[model samples]
Target: MKKQIYIVGLILFGLLSCVQKHTKDKIESNQSRIFHYNNEPYLIKGICYHPVPKGSDQRSFETIDQDLELMVEAGINTIRVYEPIDDIDVLDKINSAGLKVIIGFGYNQNGNYDILSGSFIDYVKKYIDHPSILMWELGNEYNYHPEWFNDDITNWYKALNESAALIQEIDKKHKVTTAHGELPDALALKMTDRIDVWGLNIYRWDNPSELFEQWEKVSEKPMYLSEAGGDSYMTITKQGYEEGFNEKAQADANAKILESIFNNREVCSGVTMFSFTDGWWKAGDTDTQDIGGWAPNSSGVPYDGTPNEEFWGIVDIDRNKKETYVVIKNKYKQTLTEY
Candidate 1:
């Protein structure tokens, strides 16, 4: 009867797995101008994740288990990735750990899988039923690059809107969003009517409160800060914070930034702060940590007022928690209880 026993065991395992499936929460943003998960008002306590190991330029999930443990510890509920994740096992691990993901697609990736090539929809259709998916984000601050779209940014917006509409048509369960630099202009908003939510990659010197007031005057659609936080390395000393890789600069700035975001919850959704771990590949050498890198509209980057791209992570290259990690954990945990 060994054959019979084996078949029974397989059935039992399948049943248990089905019972343990992660929450199949439907996400939407409506007239309320806030995200609702399972019809309950939801806030995205998220982090921008690109865990490229040292000595490499490619994103890797080899340390996903360790990464998830740290993410869970920080009370982060969502991971905002810059590219679609193709591996089913990685998505499974993230789902099993009780987390959600915002999959971002680029306008062009030299033909592989991007919106311009019409291949990004393939990823959407593939992962449409995956429980871990919170939203499908299109483009990351592409408005800053008109040159890429034949010297006309509206061309990019048209493509973005069209692609977003297609994804929504296919996956009615999830919202389609975009990470625009700063705030969208009247033309930008008009062109992107199909975009469900606006993700502003804002940097207003640790004080982004004013943007909410401006947004209220402009449009009522849901919005969130897709990238707002300081890097650890200071280009120059200002305020009372010292220069030279001071973790406190990042910590202090992020603390204030979080405060601004939460205080304006009525007009904005929660933030997916700058990042998870330091990306050594942003500048100079992939094998070493470099201090200098540039970003559009980054004159408001904390005390030093510079992007310092390589040092933006709340955790360092090895996944060691920085002072900012504790700040984020405390804020996110406290906010979770409130909701």
Candidate 2:
């Protein structure tokens, strides 16, 4: 009798979970179908892309075309950028590339609220009508550096909220989101009214389901992994660059993250991997291989700074596809229903 009851309970729980997933899928699918760029739904596959040879505002039509060609091969549909672009032809190039953008307006704008607020509104007035835009990225990893900030954090929130509210008032055509370094930064701040979607640059090594469950408990707004997947290169002393692990490790780690997101599509609106190409210049002119600095916890590990930063790219500096590239390339080809 007890065995029969246990089986029944397990069946009931499975049924309830399926029903819940179906309801969430319905809601997300409906949203994906309308009011988005080109009348499609929220984009599921993307890459945190900056094809520039270096981290500069320098632009060239030839480089843009070459970079986008690789993206085409990878089957990614969207790209997220950090600066405020004023070049019409540059925007046109991105539009012509058959890709959409989530334009970022960073809050680290000299830490001046009045100046930042005014400039934020100005950017909205310029690109709000552009067809290439998908969403307004209001803040970029601003909440992670509290030590750098001497004032109350509420002031930061006030400015960020104002920027989001202004865009909603004037544009109302695009969605708004604030990118944080982690789930805690996103959860610590209050962003109830103005923001539409939540963006997290999450690097959590485990418990993805619990993290999303925690997020759902706190906010019902849609969210995505704005930046993820990095492989650490620990040297003999773990201090300098000597290739700790090969590209296979990065590929596998990212593949696992992609699979997890596919399974928990309810909490995951979309995802953008850390990079498309290796930023050879990230460490400086002299050092090309030591670009992995995004990893913070390095107690038992080798080296310290950012052992995972340089090699985060799916492709190398020259746009050659890595193993991780092949995995995500195949995954990006699938649609929302298929995934």
Candidate 3:
């Protein structure tokens, strides 16, 4: 009888250990380093803004506040701003508005790449404590020219790992991601391990479904669309905006691309459209060969007039929601209900 009791006790202990292990796994899987109001993954949906520097008399805090209020009402929980080197007050305003921020690092002009100077450790220590920060993006589209950094792909990975390590050491709660342009399966293998999540920028010419399928095969991590949409010009020019080939065409393409991603919720985390407004840089301007097809020249230079129809914003420069915005809102509503 004593021997039988000892066997039963061993079985009970084993079961208890299994239960504890399972509980721990569940907790870690659901943990979010960013904003967690009630231990649930905060569903972040929002837009990205071009760098709006503080004390730019043209851009006021009140303007930003109004925009944030609009976004929150539209069901957005976060906003990823361009990497601001020094703008604590603006950061505070963002936090006060109740939106999480994904801070970007690393900037390159032409082929020159530069990490934020100073002790990497000090940089992490300074901002890790900020309540609004959600994640750290090592760079935007840094993989575009790996040869520029170092001909060796391994060197790029090492750099990414180093940056990620610094951020993790200071703030383990926040996640790390890197934005990359879509390429055939052969090219993406280079930077897969360097990032926690994948940031893909898609143009109108590319099929969203096809791109998603190719990336999904090799990557199990969540993905987000860092940039999307094309020039909305009515006229088509080779050097001008090419995504949709025209305004209505661009809008229609945007709707289709977004719909495809939304339907496949299991693999996608979320998407941030290319921009909120027309900016001075004419990269999206169609008239300039240097700037390429992303921008159409409707509003003309310096963005002084009613933004041209080619400007791919849910709202025109006038700040009116377009058909694309309606489609987006409807799709968002459907997703919330279904998910």
State which candidate has the highest lDDT.
Answer: 1
Model 1: per-residue lDDT, tens digit, 69-120? Answer: 9999999999999999999999999999999999999988976569999999
- The candidates, ranked best first by lDDT, are 1, 2, 3
Flag regions of model 3 displaced more than 4 Å. Answer: 1-39, 42-44, 51-62, 107-121, 150-154, 183-194, 204-207, 237-247, 283-310, 337-339
Q: What CA RMSD would candidate 3 show?
A: 11.9
Q: Give the TM-score ranking, best first.
A: 1, 2, 3
Writing each residue's lDDT as its tens digit, candidate 3 over 1-339 gives 999999999999999999986654232221222223234444446566652222231323445766666666555656765553345787787788887777666644232223534244454577777887777777676556667566765565567767776666667677777666553244445544546666666653524677666656766666767766544544434333453324455556566776766555555566776555544334443332122333222232111212232355555544566665666566555455122
Off by over 4 Å in 2: 1-40, 52-62, 110-117, 184-192, 232-245, 291-307, 335-339
RMSD of each: 12.6, 7.2, 11.9
Predicted structure 3, TM vs. truth: 0.68
Better of 1 and 3 by lDDT: 1
On the 0 to 100 scale, the lDDT of residue 36 in model 2 is 42
Q: Single out the weakest 10-residue window by summed lDDT for candidate 1.
A: 22-31
Screening candidate 1 with a backbone cut-off below 3 angstroms (N, C-alpha, C), the clashing residue pairs are: none
Estimate the overall C-alpha local distance difference test score of candidate 3. 0.56
Task: For candidate 2, give the lDDT.
Answer: 0.67
Error of 1 at 244 (Å): 0.3
Overlapping backbone residue pairs in candidate 3 total 9
